[model samples]
Target: MGFFPDLPITTERLTLRPFTRGDVDAVLDYRGREDVALYLFDAPLSREECALAVQQRILQTSWSEEGDKIVLAAVLSESDTLIGELSLIWRSEDARQGEIGWIFHPDHHGRGYATEAAGALFDLGFQGADLHRIFARCDARNGSSWRLMERLGMRREAHFREHALFKGGWDEEFVYAVLRREWRNGG
Candidate 1:
């Protein structure tokens, strides 16, 4: 057996659980928007693509080995509306390192939902999985994402300058990381 948090992890305002087949439409609400996909690896998904993505996400609920991940749907606890998604990818089992990322509905911005959801993931990674370190990366131009990482108590570790070509242009990247000690110390 490997590290896998029990499903339906709850925070103050959101529930993080495995994606269900019925979640396609809700996922498409944000994933289908151009602005939402601006910093993501993939472009805005179509309805069909969202369905496929949800299907893929449904099977990615466990992190049992290196390269495995837990992809969770972030739903409103009050309304049960799917507003976003969170992921924790196991990058190196030997090093006990993980990578985290998030995407939320544009309409749901500014309410700290991303931070709440990501905090839960941090707990799972650090407390549940016993990971030594967790990191997040975002496009340098994505202020909101890096800011959210900061709010999660992550420190900026690196700033890569135009290292990779993305969306037909040079893409600068920012990497942020937190250690288990820092997270457990309430950071």
Candidate 2:
């Protein structure tokens, strides 16, 4: 249950860490790629732009209290290379629930990194942060990420049509949830 508060979070082959000023280059390198930002809320960002965004996020997470948000950078444990990012946001006024999401470099896709990091964040959000539930919503067209949600034992609770506008017109999406009572890990 021990986590690297601001340094890094380690998995067998990955390390979930916090953002650093030095991370500007990596953030710029990957974030600027169209494929990486395709599903994200924003368009491709330059390194300078992402650095500002990263700093803002860092400030928010660093100053958060018990019932606030948590964002982690997924890095390669061995080399500590930042590969992706994950987040847990407590949207409930009482901080009883959270919403989780992630974005990984396309080069790092299909390696199970997103799912592994997501599960770890879920554990932290619930067991560590004492949240009652953690859920995620994404465009239905994002089948890969949605599949990861299912793999993490979340159940699809809702599907909204034309709920958002992406690169073009409207988009439909699904919501998935997992309650604290329903979470289980392999022994």
Q: What local distance difference test score does each model get?
A: 0.93, 0.78
**Cα RMSD of predicted structure 1:** 1.2
Every model's TM-score: 0.97, 0.88
Superposed model 1: Cα runs more than 4 Å off: 184-187
Q: Give the per-residue lDDT digits (tens) of candidate 1, residues 64-134.
A: 77899899999999999999999999999889899999999999999999998999999998888888999
Task: Indicate which candidate wins on lDDT.
Answer: 1
Worst 10 residues of 1 by lDDT: 1-10
Q: Give me the candidate number with maximum TM-score.
A: 1
Cα error, candidate 1, residue 43 (Å): 1.3
